[model samples]
Target: MPPLFKHPNFVHFWIGQIASSFAFQMLSVGIGWQMYDLTNSPMALGLVGLCQFLPQLLLTLVVGHVADRYNRRLICVCTRFTMAMTVGILAYGNITDSISANMIYLCAALLGTARAFEMPANQAILPNLIPNELLSRAVSAIASAREISVIAGPALGGLIYLIGPTTLYLSSMSCFLVSCVIMFFLHYNFTVKTKSPISMEHLFGGLRFIRGNKVILGSVSLDMFAVLLGGATALLPIVAKDILHTEAWGLGLLRCSPAVGALLMSIYLARRPLTHSVGKIMFAAVAVFGVATILFGLSENLILSMIALVLLGSSDMISVVIRSTLVQLETPDDMRGRVSAANSVFIGSSNQLGEFESGVTAAWFGVVPAIIVGGVGTIAVVGLWMYLFPNLLKRDTLEQ
Candidate 1:
């Protein structure tokens, strides 16, 4: 067995992460495809991302505090259970022929709330499970596992969707429920007894820490801007239906192409983790991501598009690993939850908010133009960030 997997707590946590991540990916495919199908409007699809992000924006102040002071594992379990129920509600609505776009929006908001709590707690839990020596590998393992789900979830969701939306929802619900059960068995040795009362200062401590740390700030903000500008995943449904003239299964393949690249890169990193020139590597990866996005935007052929997506995903995995490991290693354990929550804000902005941006741009400029412009913008951000944050640009190693 791999030395990392020998840690039982980490093993259980890893399993739960896979289950929940798989569920979320399937849910995303279902929601994106369904919303686009119903409204045939780019704006409605954008609103789905908006709904999910609003909760994260609202909860950022409180989520990290809760994760630090409370039981992170319990928080994970509760969030998974909440997601199970929320998806079940979605399934019920579908079965009853009462599922509206608005209903999906509401469910999305609820799921986002659950995710807001789950992410920080889940991230904070990692350092507690394994030794410091294993931290990078742990992060790599989890990212790789997530890529596996990313690879499978959409494809499976697309296939099962042929069976029906209701069936897909039910399948996602089952995965969340299973995650809840798996997390219940995860045990780690830690006790939280709020040392300080909640105050405005305490709530924003993570942000303060990030602000003082230029490396963390630069790394995270770079990712935020690059992804915010470059994110094309949100427009796959449009590309599949209108541009590519493909069906649900084709959309699934389109969605998973990046993950296929990410999965292969993640596995390689797991075996030979980045030990030097980490910062430059990360910036280069983001640059590649930008280029790949542009390639994807310009390509009309499905195979060419998939190839572009694969390169995009591979580049993204490098950034994800370097950024994640740097954040976790830099923050003290007591501060990890809040710091992770703050990190989540950046991540959420890049992903969910990026979707909104993509939708708005697509609506105004047309889908193809929106993607191309975003790709160019991403490349611009990389060049600008390199000039702006030289400390980040000069960073040579992941080790602090």
Candidate 2:
């Protein structure tokens, strides 16, 4: 057995992550497709991203502090349960033919709130599951799990969407419930001993830590800006409907294309991890991601678009594995939660907020132009970041 699978806690964590991630991906497809169907406006889709991201933006500090102070496992379990219920609401509403665009916005907000807590806690707990030597591979393994969901969830959701939105919502809700139960049984030693009463310093500790650590800050920010600019996934529905002239199933395949590339890259990295020039490799991967995004934006053929997405995911997996391992290995365990929380903000900003950006830009400049511009912006950020964070560019390995 692989070292990661041998650890029972890690296995449970892995399975739980898969379930939750799968549910979320399906929820995304369901909500996004439904939102677009109801309003037929690109701006409404943008609002979906905005509503989901606002909670995370507001709760970053409190979330970090809570993760650091409270029991992380409990936090994770409760968050999953909350998400299950949130989706359950959607399922009920859809089944009764009472759902609306506003309801989706509200659910997006609730789902975002749950994820704001869940993401950082999950990131913090991984180090506790295995020795430091295996951290890189573990990160890759987790990414592979997520990629599998990304590949499967959307395709399945797209197929299931043909049945009914209610069915998709119920399926997603059940997945979230399963994840909650699995995480409830997950065991971990919470040795964090922060007794300092609520103070500004404690709340902002994660941000401060990242600011002080140039490599960590640079790596996280690089991803934030690059993806923030190059987030083409947000416009997949528009692309599939108008450009590719396809339906829900085609959208599902379009959504999963990147994951297919990401899954393959992640599996390879897990088996044979990066050994040297890790910093250079990550930058190169981001550059490739930018180029792929441009290709995707320009492609009208479904096959060509899928190929571009595959490249995007493959390159992105390299960057994710490198950045995740770097941040976790560099931070002290006691501070992991807080630091991971701050890191999650960067991730949330890049993904959720980036979707909003893409939507707004697509509305303003047209979908293809917005995507192409974002891709160009991503490449520009990479060049600028290399100049700004020379330490990250020069860093030799993931090991502290």
Candidate 3:
């Protein structure tokens, strides 16, 4: 068996992840493209992200407890099943030409709720699927899987969009079916160490743990702030249409560029995991991410912009692998759900809230200035975080 595929459970789990993530990425491409196409308003695009993120902010602890106390494979099955139904409705609406913007917002909210519950269990389940020794490589393997989805999803979504919105939605619904089937076959007995009463602390323990652990606190917060400011994915539709002078096809290639870089980097990291000065490397990677974002914002030329995105994806993947390793390895098996839930909030804000910010900012200032300023803010956040979380910055090695 290969290093990442050493365990059968891990193999099944990864297969499920592939389908789930593929559906998600394709859904994202469809939503962003469709919303922008409908309203021609950047704010509408931002609202899509906001509706998706708000559910996690409200139900973080509740979902965390569910992950801890429940059968996670079952949770994965149930959520994706709902997602399939929801997207199926979208497909029907598109075919009927009756899917209103309000309906899209409502659908996005449902999808977000499902994702909020799904992420904690999904993240927490990984430790049970593989041994501690293989964790670093496993994390890389996971990134590779996600990057593959990111690479293929947009490219495919954009191509399929040429056929019609119904085609795109139907494709996503099918991917969700595959995810559900794989989850059913995944066999892993999750051992929950928590035998305590359901108290407020038990519910919120993950947040407390992260609060005290400067490393987790610093790393998660850093990601939250950096990407919260630096992410340009939300503005890409605008860039592709208004600035790059490209249509849906060009948008697909642009979206794929970063993941292309990430997929290549993940293959390298899987074979030769980072072993020393891990903290320093992570910070440097974020800085690189910030610079790449800036370069992308300024470039009007398609080739230069694509190269910048590749750098952005590569650097961000390094940061992701390091943070995931640090957070997961440091937590006890039982607290993984809560901690991962807390981590998911950070991720949701980085991605979803960041999208909102991009739209709002673009509405206030032009898209070009909004993107450039956000990239600068990302760089600033890194410096500030480096100062605040010195332990994370000075820390070395992925193996605790």
Candidate 4:
């Protein structure tokens, strides 16, 4: 096997993720476009985020427990299969021209439930698939592949949208089906056939562990809050259409541009690896992310906005690499699923809640104002977190 593809499971797993990532990207673009077009209301866009995130927010504890006690591989396969089915139904509706805002919302809810389960299982399964020595590289490799998918998927989705919305939905369903099939080939299986009785103590264990470890707490919480405040993805549709005066093609390109920067950065991280001032680097990256977002909000020109987005993505990639490595390395395998579950909840809240916030704020204030305010809030979060997690800031390296 090549250095990047050392473990057979990792290879198969990474391939599945790339396919699914592309599908997910397309789903996002298609739905975002459709929602805005159907209602032409900013709040409707906000509801899209709310519907998708509600399941994860409501079921985090239960989902994590299930991941820990069940076969992680099988869980991933099942959840993704469920997702495929949900997307297939959406495709059918699109093909029939019977898709309503209400129908789309329902599909989003089902997909979110499937995703809520898949995320923790997928994260927990990674360390088990490859050697510890190769974990960082594996992580980077996975991130890079996912970024590639995001880059291509949006562009493809846009082109497909031009052909017909039905084509785009069907294409996403095909990708999801392919991902589910490929994921089933992993050879090693880990499962706890019989789980202990469920209890409040067990449910909150992941939270306790994280709170006790300042390093992990700082890293995870920082990301959760920073991205929550800084993220402008929820408004990108608005920017691509009303602000930049671009159509579906431009929207697709705008979506893909950030991933291009992220893809390039992930490749660099895979090769060189971050060896020093890991915590400081993460903080710096987040601050840069905030600054870039502010610039993006201010830019009216398409080229400048794209440049800002590239910077935004590259900065975010650095934070992602650092945070994921820290969380995985610091956690024990037995507890990884629960911890990852907790992490997923935080992420879900940030991304989804942020979307809702942007929509409401955009509705109340204006798109540009809401975005600029988010950027400033993100910068403030970095400063406050740096102070709170001084140990994380003083920490020297990624090596444990």
- 10 residues in a row with least lDDT, candidate 1: 185-194
TM-score of 4: 0.88
Q: What TM-score goes with each of the models?
A: 0.88, 0.88, 0.87, 0.88
lDDT of 3: 0.89
- Residue 255 CA error for candidate 2 (Å)? 3.2
Q: Rate the local accuracy (lDDT) of all candidates.
A: 0.89, 0.89, 0.89, 0.85
lDDT of 4 by residue, 81-121 (tens): 89888888887887788888999899999998999899988
Q: What's the TM for model 2?
A: 0.88
Model 3 residue runs over 4 Å out of place are: 29-46, 91-103, 158-168, 192-194, 237-251, 298-300, 356-373
lDDT of residue 259 for candidate 1: 88
lDDT of 1 by residue, 29-106 (tens): 899999888889978987898788888888997999988888888999999999999999989998999999999999
Colliding pairs, model 2:
none
Off by over 4 Å in 2: 32-45, 94-103, 161-166, 235-253, 297-302, 352-373
lDDT of 1 at 115: 91
Model 2 Cα lDDT, one tens digit per residue, 54-89: 888899888887788888899999999999999998
How close to the true structure is residue 332 of candidate 3, measured as C-alpha lDDT? 85
